[model samples]
Target: MTICRLEVSNPAFTPDNTQFVTVHSSHLNRRHDVSIYNVNAQTENVPIIVLMHGVYGNHWVWMGLGGIHHVYERLRSEHKISEFVLVMPSDGGLRDGSAYLPTKGHGNYEQWIMDDVITAVQKTVENVTINSPLYLSGLSMGGYGALRLGAKYAEQVSGISAHSSITDLLELTEFVDHSLDAYDCRNLHESNIVYWMNKNKNKLPPIRFDCGREDILYSGNIRFVEELKSNGIPHIYETFEGEHSWEYWHTHIVQTFEFFSDIQTHRR
Candidate 1:
């Protein structure tokens, strides 16, 4: 990963247990910010969860809107989950969204997440290292990114969890105002979630996803689950009672935290 320059915020100036990092990435040829939450900075060998946001959202969405830091703190205090460093990153600053895919003219948003984001976290967080377990997660378009990228880079990820995901690239049209041509890539398969999951099926890490029963993407998620079943891919899928609102994600994200914590405990 080629980072032209790096900048980290002063912890004292930021909210408790949270900091921001800015990386000038060669992949995107622009500076992007990442919001990090480390409840206990002195703890080492903890897992890192990279939370990608959906369309029209930036790095602060997870904490600012979802209150993920508060969720993490509550989960830890209640002894329901293990320690983790939360990393929230922007989606390459494309029009409405980047879909976290590499485009011919739009720069490699995929590489920005798979490479630059990880590198930034390793550098800026003292508790995070190259060897620490990494988890991928997100909401809506971000959910698609987590599922696709986690499958494509299975060897590097420990687990994946997505909420109300867009199963295919075409689904982006329903949410964004930009034309599909903006996401054009040499290999169409690169934009497909099932393609990567099938290609790396054998090496895939633990996978799970959920959708609100009333979400517009609910039908797509059901079809996706069926495809996974027919292909014999191992995953966990569930439906909740809510819509595609922040309230739904805020309440359900606890499931993902618990899932990751269970995986970590088993690994130990």
Candidate 2:
């Protein structure tokens, strides 16, 4: 594993440095990079939120284009919700996005996140204990990942929130140009958000997700919510004014952090 630290001198910010660790995945047979935020504080038992990125995005998407650093600063300074570690990891750059799925032979992106990525973070990041609370949020394909993996590994995370999430492989391949030959269509159909939630009904974590009014995935989000209701699963779903753009995600992710914070407080 390769480790590096980025120290930024921003007079207006409290924590000016971000650490990055690249973990070699036996599943993917490659090195995956994870960008960490706010590791300086003594966050012993704080919840760690993993922010997965959309297709065509890398680990830096949250920190760079998503302006998460600005949002983190605002939360700590203004909202006083400090002491959580933010982990941003890539999807192994599988064509478009891996959908965080495990292929038969090539590599297992799902295991890379649920197994390799989390393990690597706990080892490399200081002050992060094995018992630190975990949460997940993502957008687009990343949203699909967080929801599916969060359910599949229900015991690992405390809660999950997704924005503009793709509910199925069909919807995902519609927007991207990559061929999804590696994904099992049968498995994809079975792993649809609603399907997975139904399969893991009793084991689900606290769940919430939102979609923009103009987002192409808006209809899918609505359908998934309906399925949840029909299946007696409780969650928070809302519609906001925006589209499937960075501006939309950047503004609303703050609410996700707050939601996780609430869960953390109540659990204590």
Candidate 3:
């Protein structure tokens, strides 16, 4: 795969992560602007961690704590995490934040992820190939995207880390009784998972999740963990001291990166 970096100048953009870029994908055939950081090229295929944001959020959330560049550079030279590229793409415009869902008469938010976004990563980054495999991780809206896409296309993603993520939309709709606004996209039902599993249940990827005890989204994460456990699914579910804020996500993302690297080693 061939990759190239792009300069982003979108009026709707937000400042979240350390260093950001836009990658144009040729495999899935789509144009995507992705924010990437902490990249290190090696002779073999490098492991990548796709960082996603919640509703009404942009790539800048990763940089909200003001340490993305420092962390990225440190990981590259000291921690050897330089082989991992942090990617944050435009899932969709903020007004249409449907938890990365497909809205009617609006935009195909899921496509923004399922489409050539992966191809764009393959092209823009060196050694990060597509149609091969990847480690998926996300927060909130991104958490939903990571699980949905990972389940739907088990052939692509090898593992998933969904932090404070809502898995079952049908269950999520129990709380959201409003229209399918950008916010409405946050609720996910269990039926959605079943549908994807039915299509590829024979080969579902591994998943892990965590949520704060005080978070409003805590119940959703717990319920998801319960269901997965009841069905004999092995997943990592724990309660951490945090809320639905970047401070929590920022701290958690680092650990998630290590988890992703371990999975990649297992795959190798």
Q: Which candidate wins on TM-score?
A: 1
How close to the true structure is residue 139 of candidate 3, measured as C-alpha lDDT? 79
lDDT of 1: 0.90
Which candidate gets the maximum lDDT versus the true structure? 1
Model 2 misplaced stretches (Cα beyond 4 Å): 1-15, 80-82, 184-190
Root-mean-square deviation of every model: 1.1, 3.8, 5.4
Global CA lDDT computed for model 2: 0.81
Q: In candidate 3, where is summed lDDT lowest over 10 consecutive residues?
A: 182-191
Model 1: residues with Cα > 4 Å off, grouped in runs:
none
The C-alpha lDDT values of all candidates are 0.90, 0.81, 0.63
- Sorting all predicted structures by lDDT, with the top scorer first, yields 1, 2, 3
Candidate 3 lDDT tens digits, 121-156: 666566677544577777776787787777777777
Worst 10 residues of 2 by lDDT: 2-11
lDDT tens per residue, model 1, 1-268: 4898899888778888888889999999889999999835676766899998998899999988998788888998999998899999999999899999887686889899989999988887888889899999999999999999999999999999999999988888999887788775558587878888899988999999999999999999999999999989999999999999899999999999999999999998
TM-scores vs. true structure, each candidate: 0.97, 0.91, 0.77
TM-score ranking, best first: 1, 2, 3
Error of 3 at 193 (Å): 3.0
214: Cα error in model 3, Å: 1.3
